[model samples]
Target: MTLDLYRADLGGRTREWLALHPDERRRRSVQACATKDVEALWSLTEAHLSLYGGSGLLASPHTFSAYRTGIRQFSQYAETQALNLLRLTPDDAQAYVLALLAQGRKIATVRGKVASASALYKALRWAGATDTAPFVGVRVPKDHEHPLTKNPPYSAAVLRRVLGVVEERLLSACGRERERLLRARTLLLLLAHTGLRIQEALDLTWEEVHLDEDEPFLTVRSGKGRKSREVYLSDRLVMALRLDRTLPRRRSHTAGMVLPFRTRAAAAKLLKPLFERVDEQGRVRSDWRGCHAFRKQTGTRLYEALHDFAAVAEVLGHADINTTRAYVRVGGRRAGKVMRDW
Candidate 1:
């Protein structure tokens, strides 16, 4: 452990009587850091969490797995720096960027490095290296290439059909797997319908969902830049959540977190491939579609249905609406033409 930010902690299992606790599950990520040396071990854990913590690329489901590629790339460039701590200066940062460039990394790949590296410097400063910032004067070079698009949200009909099939499969699942699958399906739909980042959706609990109304919304304690927002849910989605949550949650397994899946990693594993089984042509696609693609698809819908950037941004939990707008420019139009106008 290296962060020591968690108050009460355990691995593999939480305290007695706290089973099925969604809060404890969300807390588990910080708990892994319960034994960490926060000040000294500033690079790996601190830098990684900051990027995913919603600080810079706020509301993005930033997995360290998504980042490992960049770290490995930077390490190769680190050898080019001849013994300088990779976190010490712009020279190191620039060299790393050049290495990525020389390797023909995409702009998105390079952007990840810039964001991750900046977080590392901030973490170093947070760890008391106040005089240093490895990113001073460094910048993400303007990407003159094609703009990045939001993966269009699934069509209303596709969203309906896939969910219907997955729910059928879920209800028919035998034994304990049912509850787990149910939780995963519920969370997956919630992610797509509401446009929550994976971390925000992962942090949900039965309590945060208000099922009393025809339309339900989830209230999440926002991480990343420390902002929270209330996200609305569709009526159909709300009914699904209300019905599924009616089960006496397995008290022996939960530790106060909202949903069944605890960590983002666990949620990622549990929730992916649930409903994204269909492709754009209404055909059964591969099972590789992830939680993020759902969020992206939601953005796609906003561009088509409302054509409002702010609405799409609000749904996706982005601090800046431009982030949502960019998606419309890049991906949503194609999605619109392909999905409906065609």
Candidate 2:
């Protein structure tokens, strides 16, 4: 009855659905229509995602999680408003958007929530559960704020200071704490040098890393949009990783993971103290972007070194050059240098 229950049921059915032949899946879709089975109707969401969710074979776990979150929020709103999802109208959809705005959700957040609901309805239509798509043309408000003004990359000075703190911690620590600090340092250095998104870095395996190769690089198997790319390593980073590999790990550790931490939250928790440290002036800036700052730093430095947007995009694994541009911050000093030469 509740969307959560539907999601739970869908989780159980995912493997079963994936195993079915295309013709068999179509047959089940027709059978669900004939039998009026609500569970069968829900399975169609997975079917739609598998066919069209842009990962070619199946939607990535991250994509599925996002869609589930969006759908859950919308379903909660529908319950409060006494509206049925299958019977929702344009007015109902618009009211849900208005309600989200009233709750002070950011424009981007609202857009993602709406997109989740829209995708659910799309799957429902494919299942013949509903004829009308209420969220198809719902007008989520646009964000007018400029991208460059948001989340600026960490400067080289700040990174060096943080790394200095990490080294100091490594010197005083022992046993498991030392092992953790070592992994944390390696993870930070990888992010700083390679410009990998935190998830991408966390997902890296020992097999993907090529520290001994002449042009040392690691392969990201599935980045944003499930696109894979090679990120070459810095000499310093290669040395660090090589040292990290030689360090003794616990017998219970995951077999082939590059970083010791299993999850992004665990990695963030380990690095929080280092990233949140106060500067000499004892001022802590409210906007600390944690690991992403390292990625932006890499992008900015790469752009400076390469002077080509396309090359930066390829290194960053960004599908769009515009997205890569946002990560490349040209600070006043860099601008001044360029202008002085001109």
Candidate 3:
């Protein structure tokens, strides 16, 4: 993958993959021991990851990591059964599903694990690394899990409290400190209003940010599925973006990149204080915390205001509308309205 499509999940594998001669990689796959088979498949997975990463078809780093975790777990299963990669059968796939279910993982979580395994097999088959796609047409149970129930959105009051501190800091600080604080505030506001994923925002370049336009918006390039979308700027968020642009240069970088923060961890490091403050003040609810709450909040508000699932889905950069639906909370107001006849 080129720089724009590269994901942190693949890490150093990209270099490793590039180092291998193309003909050697394909030739080596023909004579595979269990270890060699797995290695070859993994190398091919990395290659596809680059393609998918470029198109934004891949999920977050955590999701990519989950795929690797599933592969590792499957490898363990293979070893215990004395089965090579090609020897994996439909029965083995069933056993894996049963084992995951037996572990009492939530149905949704188990589904993800199974899906990851399935993806590995599918990729292997496509790359000619394996003879068969073992998990093909395997029956996986549907999960009734609600998205809103998982990472429950923060209440308006809590979100306000969390963002309010950043706003205050931006307005009050001076010199380089003010610039630092401004960047943090801008990042928070972008997450809050836009519903862009953490990676997509960090991947932004100056060319994508339109501050002076009649309708200000951020051109989100690295959205999921590689689908680029425009996140319309809110009046307040527009102000934040403008202020952030005005700040003194903090780090040297190539042209077009928006934030000086290089990685997801860097961005998270800058927001740790805000998250901690929310934790200290008891503003964060049972399970909700950090930047994701802003995304959920954005989803909830936009869905409620526009009353259009597709609109919200588009804004959130979800390839599937159902994915966007999960981020929206079914608040009491909507429930109450439905029960209004009573």
So what's the TM-score on candidate 1?
Answer: 0.66
Each candidate structure's TM-score, on Cα atoms with residue i matched to residue i, is 0.66, 0.82, 0.76
Model 2: per-residue Cα lDDT over 208-299, one tens digit each? 99977889999997687777899998888888899889887565566688876667678788777776765589987433577787888888
Ranking by TM-score: 2, 3, 1
Flag clash pairs in model 3.
55-225, 55-226, 56-225, 56-226, 57-225, 206-256
Candidate with maximal TM-score: 2
What is the TM-score (0 to 1) of candidate 2? 0.82
Each prediction's RMSD over C-alphas, in Å, is: 9.4, 5.6, 5.4
Worst 10 residues of 1 by lDDT: 9-18
Question: Candidate 3, TM-score vs. the true structure?
Answer: 0.76
Best by lDDT: 2
Candidate 3 — what's its lDDT? 0.72
lDDT of 1 by residue, 1-342 (tens): 574333242221112213324454324323322323233233333343544454532433445445544444444455455534423566767767777778788767788877655664454343343346666677657776544332334456766776676678876797777777667667767777787777776666667777775555777765455566778888767766876766555555664556765567787677556545655788976544556667767777767788678877766767887677655553544677788945
